[model samples]
Target chain A: MDKKRIEIKNEADIVLARQAGRKMAQSLGFGPADQTRLATAISELTRNVIQYAQQGIFEICDQSNRKAIIIRVMVEDFGPGIADLDKAMEYGFSTSQSLGVGLPAAKKLVHKFSIKSKPGHTKVTMVMTRKRV
Target chain B: MKIPILQLKNLLLTSIQVELTDRDAIDFQYDVVHKVAETGAEGLVIDITAMDVVDSFIARALNETARMARLVGAEVVICGMQPTVALTLVEMGRELIDVESALNLDHGFEKAQRLISAKKRMPG
Candidate 1:
């Protein structure tokens, strides 16, 4: 499979990330519900890159087993890292005027979630699995 | 670039049948607020069953539209969020707590009716 990846530096980049993620999810046999979940998660993360860091890379990879294929998304940005990762993950916590549902809510959209950050770097990863059906 | 807004009785309905860009969402918000004023509609229902996803920007615009509608004495109901879209929005931390939403268009119409009646009963 061709590695699904895109650079997110603007509103258009965020759209591309969602489309690429959706295509990868579709190829991995993800159901429409799961596909939408992955795409929305990608949208949320790429939006963070544009809103916070101003630029970033969004990459999609696949891991497979005999019965299932896992689609993984990674978003990395060199923006202002979260001062409090834990706080950021809490629902209803926004440093901006937003509804504060971006980071913490994205965690629930996938089977797995992880984030790491320091002053100029932030990285988030999410994964969903599609069992052959 | 104008998203159609339909007026029925005392209610207004808008169904976004196309993929929306940031510009679309922005223009939609602007249009919705003004339409509510122009029509003096008491209820607004936004049907999004055809939409599979709403990004953060769109989410914000929707929330703003809801608030603006309320400010103009109109109650807004968002209806027909697909199961997947609902799940994703909740997971994304956008519960849209401030806006009233329904499971489908029919339910949305019911909710709009209720909200309008409730407002009429409110002491001014």
Candidate 2:
């Protein structure tokens, strides 16, 4: 499966990325719940990409025959990376003025989530299944 | 811009009737919370069905309203949570622990009635 990538630079891009995630999920016949979850997760991550990273790329990939889709979003910037992954995942923890629910909410929406970050880069990957309930 | 306060049986329900877009969300939230608190209502029903998206700020304000209402011995119920709004909230991970939510206005009223009734039944 070819990876589909979108470079996000602002808040508007976050909205577009969410719509894209929902469209892809719907086209694959995922349930409404799953579709909403995926769209919301993507929106949260993409917003972070614009706010914290200043820019990032959102990539979507289809896993053949597994009835699953993989969303790998990488938000990269020269900004300071998170010093504590654990604290970053904690609810109500935020470095910005906005509500600190971004990372934790994204984690809750997917089956598999992983985060890798350095002093200048952050990559978050989440996997969702297309199987109907 | 005006949120009407309605009284139903011992419970005072205020419908949050505002068209808050992302642009005015911050101001709208602050105004709503303060007004609801001032009304001294026993309960509040915030209808956000007109809102298609709720950013982090709006979510935070809702949480703040819930807390404030509880402090004043009132309950806060959020209604008209569209699917997109719900998804955004879940994604933001904003804890609505302080505020109860329903799919629409009618359902929210039903739930609020139950909660208020239950509270009355509790041993004082």
DockQ of each: 0.58, 0.25
Which digits, one per residue and each the tens of the lDDT, describe model 2 over residues B34-90? 655666556667777765445555576677767766677677788887786676566
iRMS per model in Å: 1.9, 4.0
CAPRI rating of model 1? medium
- Write one digit per residue (lDDT tens) for candidate 1, span A1-133: 4577788878878778888888888887788888898888888888888888999999988877689898878999999899999899987788987667788767878899999999999999898886766
Candidates' RMSD to native: 2.5, 5.3
User: Candidate 1 on B1-124: residue-level lDDT in tens?
Assistant: 5789999999999999877767788889999999999999999999998887786667778889999999998999999888877766665664554579999999999999999999889898
Off by over 4 Å in 2: A1-6, A63-75, A97-101, A131-133, B1-24, B34-44, B49-58, B68-75, B82-96, B109-124
C-alpha local distance difference test of each model: 0.85, 0.69
Q: Give the clash count for each candidate.
A: 3, 0
Scoring only the second chain, what is candidate 1's TM-score?
A: 0.94
Which whole-number lDDT from 0 to 100 does residue B36 have in model 1?
A: 96
